[model samples]
Target: MAKDYQGEEILVVRRSLFDELGEFQGINADVDAYLPSLLNPENNFFMDRGAAEDDPSHKQLIPYCIFRVKDDQGTRYLHYTRGKSGGESRLHAQVSIGIGGHINPVDQREDHLGFDTYMAGVEREIDEELNIEGGHTNKIVALLNDDSNTVGQVHLGVVHMIDLENDDVAANEDAIANLAFTTLEELRGELYDRLETWTRCCVDVIEEL
Candidate 1:
């Protein structure tokens, strides 16, 4: 079943054993294992038709993206949150990439016009998270989709560095605790250990950029 995400909650899903094992073998194996399942025509995961009537698990998966911004001084800033998820209470701020949530049925129809459905979701997510008005000016470096790591398929929309200094962008308090720009070294040394898969993917994408 699709999980409900209240404005107050943050969901972090993990990769499957197949994903973890494939990481050591090669990227292709990992990609093949996860991607085909999602893109297969026989599978209802990517189809827009009303297969929900036949298969109860036919609900569309939520699509999301991650953004990595850098400043003139070469300091990279990632969006993050810090708080208690359950019984654990630690005053730690998790540094992660910036992006936003799923493409709702309404968003799929109205917000994204010319782009691919998934690309549209990425564009919408960036706009919603950063309060930006249009597609990112930076070049899209990579498009990654990994379902093994999440309950819903995760699409990593990697873009070239963005200059957030002049922009009026700020984190939504209800969704995050604090958002700041930190160095890559800091992210790897201090924050990576505590990060979720989505956050780890952001770091990986940024390193390639």
Candidate 2:
């Protein structure tokens, strides 16, 4: 059964704001240009997820994090498959490199909403999904958008690159399956075809970097 989002309130920005900030089809690396205004409290609000999911006028802000570790051979990235128990029914069973989800009311601070709240939600989502045994550095490297499919129409992604000192990571939830670290070549090769649309876009962004 599909999970109900009626009672949930997630953070979102107006689609008009996105267009006004200069919209693009895929991943945009220019975070500085768009993030400030998009994350501004005046430009965002918490809406009922049931309505937001079907409403393209609002884009749900999702922090899509990609974990990485540098080894003797080269840098490897963390990847996994979304299991049946995942929240987004449309993305279940799809391969992905991102580790994140919707920013909700719980992320807010005393009726306040901003980047700090968003980051708090990001950290909460990551901890709920994975167990990392080492220190890491996180950077917001890009923003993802895809309007070609039903799943992408009302969502916006903030891509994060989390560099770990060690690749000691494990899945903490049933939603994350076959969690493992893989090389860029492996991901760009055979696994490319299996990646979710947003993950595919992230792979392209990584390749260009």
Candidate 3:
């Protein structure tokens, strides 16, 4: 049992079919048992736990994105931070996506019921990076485990339309380089390859909305 940085007890819930069905409407059964099947390498629907744990390169934090699409123009924008793309040159660049990070020791509490720890991580990350006061209520569009890829766990969050035009909702310069909007078409065409499973899941949710 891996202890959280804050010396808190951590629980690793096995992937289950019930968890999957619970994410969507309708369809009820003993779904909890099926979570492992979805994560199996042979199925490839999601990543296997072995791969996620074996990889040493991945930072253990769960990353999330907060994206929005304009009602009139239908253009979507993602928030991201600027970081060093480790390579020979050690060059730094900007990435387009919203804020999210790993689960803190405070997040893995028994008192915090109903809400998932991953959701709590996203909420904390958004406030830290964007300096905005909000929460993870009904904003989560999809959840994904990225064991198949180099990046670790990821969750996609879709916030409902709000007055983003207000200048007060600005991103922290210390955390992010810039924030801007982009179209879904642009995301699919230019940015799709760079996206993680959570990004794809968010697209699915956006399609329905």
Candidate 4:
């Protein structure tokens, strides 16, 4: 069964206020600088998607990452499949370079401060989707948004780039499958139509040759 988290509260901020931070219209971002402003828990808080869904003004913050693998064969990126029973219906069969979800109320505990604490959900999502055999490094790169569309209207994507020390990452659940590693060109051409909106818009983050 698809994970129905409709009523569960998730963190978000008004787009007008989020926009005050600066231009986050598409993919232009500097994580170190942009992130600090968003860390203010007061500016953001939890609200059920059931109520926020139709309200594009309320942009649900989502932590997203693109896992990269570099080996003797060169560089490759991970793209996973969304099983039919996946929580997100619009993403089924849509190959995506990004992996992540929303922040919950429990995740906002006052004690857990700083970067690691803020990215706790991002770490959790990465571990749940890919099994890493070696040490991995990740960094926030850009902020992605597309308020033009419905999904884009309701969600804001904080994009990160993660590079693995080794090439031993694989799918950890049925919800994620087709663990394929492909070059930027390969992905851009082959998975062109299949790429999700966020991935398609933020491809450059993972398109490194």
Question: Top model by TM-score, which number?
Answer: 2
Off by over 4 Å in 2: 1-3
lDDT of each: 0.43, 0.91, 0.42, 0.76
For model 3, residues 1-209, the per-residue Cα lDDT tens digits are 43123332222333343244344321112323433343232332222333334334322333446555455666556544355431101113534454564445556434342235445655666667675433323343333443444333222122332234322356655545556667777767776665545455454455643
Residue lDDT tens for model 2, 49-128: 98888899999999999999998858999999999998888898889999999998888865378888988899999899
lDDT (Cα, tens digit) per residue for candidate 4, span 64-107: 78888888989888887778766677678888888888776656
Instruction: List the candidates ranked by lDDT, beginning with the highest.
Output: 2, 4, 1, 3
Look at candidate 1 and tell me the lDDT of residue 47. 31
By TM-score rank, best first, the candidates go 2, 4, 1, 3
Higher-scoring candidate on lDDT, 2 or 4: 2
Provide the lowest-lDDT 10-residue window in model 1.
6-15
TM-score computed on alpha carbons, candidate 4? 0.88
Q: Higher lDDT: candidate 2 or 3?
A: 2
Tens-digit lDDT string for candidate 1 (1-209): 43233332211112342244242311121333543343333332223222221232333333434444444657566556753441112223554454554434343433232235445655565655556433444444433444453322423222334544443456543455566667778777777887655456656656554
Candidate 3 off by > 4 Å: 1-63, 69-72, 85-98, 108-120, 133-138, 153-168, 173-175, 193-201
Candidate 3 local lDDT, residue 26:
18
Worst 10 residues of 2 by lDDT: 105-114
Winner by lDDT:
2
Instruction: Write down the TM-score of every candidate.
Output: 0.53, 0.96, 0.51, 0.88
